[model samples]
Target: MDRDAVRLTVMKHDEPWAGAATTTGRNGSVPHQVGAPGALAESLFLVPTRHLVALRDVLRSGEDPEGVAVELGAAAATEGIGWSELLRDVEDVCRSVSGSLPPYEVVRAMSIAWTETAIHDAYETSCEDPLTGLASAAHLRSRLDDAYRLAERSGVSASETAAFVVVEIAAGSGPDVGLLRSLSMLVLADAMRTCFDGDETIARVGEHRAVALVRRSDAIRGYRALRDLLERAVDLPPLRVWVEGLPATSDAATRLLGELGRGASATELG
Candidate 1:
């Protein structure tokens, strides 16, 4: 059987055909209908039977497929496509190439895109926000549970053990707000580390807001000290500082963060 004997028919997104990858020949490029909905998707595409669309790039006939692979990987991740499924797709592509697993370089590039997007998906509903290096609201609730549990064992209220020291930075409505907010938070986080010691968890619960779990025993005293440090380290105008006592339960504590997070500038320490 001649491996090159297959008759490949490349179809367009605008074509009347329903976007199928039906194969009829013994050897040739396998054509899958491009599903992108755009008038700009008029470019012609012919894919190898192994489903390796990069064959064009590999054969120096069309645009780069590296970006395509990345987009596929990212799309797979967001769509909740599993690894096994992705491997099957890879296998189809490989059949046109090595007829085995995908080439290491291609796999690496795709895997990187997949992993990055997958991690973002996890972070969206999980413990931490990668950009801010702070605990998500969900993470804070669990930490609160631990604090309350320990407090219970020690025969004290949660408030006796934990409190939130919040820092809210004020930025103008200018276009630079995102950059300004991030930089200000970094400065605030650094000051938080210096003043709060290592035991507390710091979290960003709202835009331009961060809260560090502080020892209520020292929160009042520490607030004044941290306020002094923030003033010195940050030249950005008007930083607000306040201490919020933990409520009776972790549930309430999570809600408290929302309330404290509102408004710009300092309020009297409560």
Candidate 2:
């Protein structure tokens, strides 16, 4: 199938007959009807049959179908689309299904689901460490940007709410390289959850360094948590370490991560 053509159709639903309902052929792309008032009905024909089934199940289980549809549609989009139009589509679908789910509930569920799905996908694809399940540095930036934007929109300065904690883990001496790396990951996961909570953003940028972004107010507490995690590192013998605190400035944060990468690779004490 021509992905480009299908992508084009996904983006522009301007024509009344350009959607799934209007196009009927055995071709891989589903036929859809494209129009304003009937957009939801058209969308049903456009989404893949399996996805449609999953969507139906969500609705049947007392979930908001409109919200589920918005997430599923956005999730499936590999190409770019106008954010305004996408949001419009979501609003329209939610309104159409208002009878099944409360209007406000549909709005809330879809908004949250959209955000959660987007975050999870971004972390999975761009920000997770394949080796140990820690977040990657790029993902760290994305997380910070999202959080900072949220704070800023809510009338808080970006710097007022965020802090960075860099944990430099010294590897074990001798031939216990594998054990050392495993220990580092364990320490990271524990420190992340205990200090920053499950919602906190943490990342492993190098073999010997992990960084966590915490609430600015929690800087001291976060540091204490790191200390505890490091103390547990004694199980790996030489895999001990010192911790450092840094402000989570957007630009400075990037530079700090870079410095950490170089410093951790060097023989300097943390």
Q: Give Cα-based local distance difference scores for all models.
A: 0.62, 0.54
lDDT of 1 by residue, 199-241 (tens): 8888777677788887877776777778878767736746767
The residue ranges of model 1 lying beyond 4 angstroms of the native Cα positions read 1-79, 82-120, 125-128, 258-270
Model 2 regions lying over 4 Å from their true place: 1-125, 154-156, 232-234, 237-249, 264-270
Clashing pairs in 1: 6-27, 29-48, 29-49, 30-48, 30-49, 50-92, 50-96
Residue-wise C-alpha lDDT for candidate 2, range 160-265, written one tens digit per residue: 6765666655555678776777666775666666766757778877667777777767766666655666566555333333333333345654565676666643
Report the alpha-carbon TM-score of model 2 versus the true structure.
Answer: 0.44
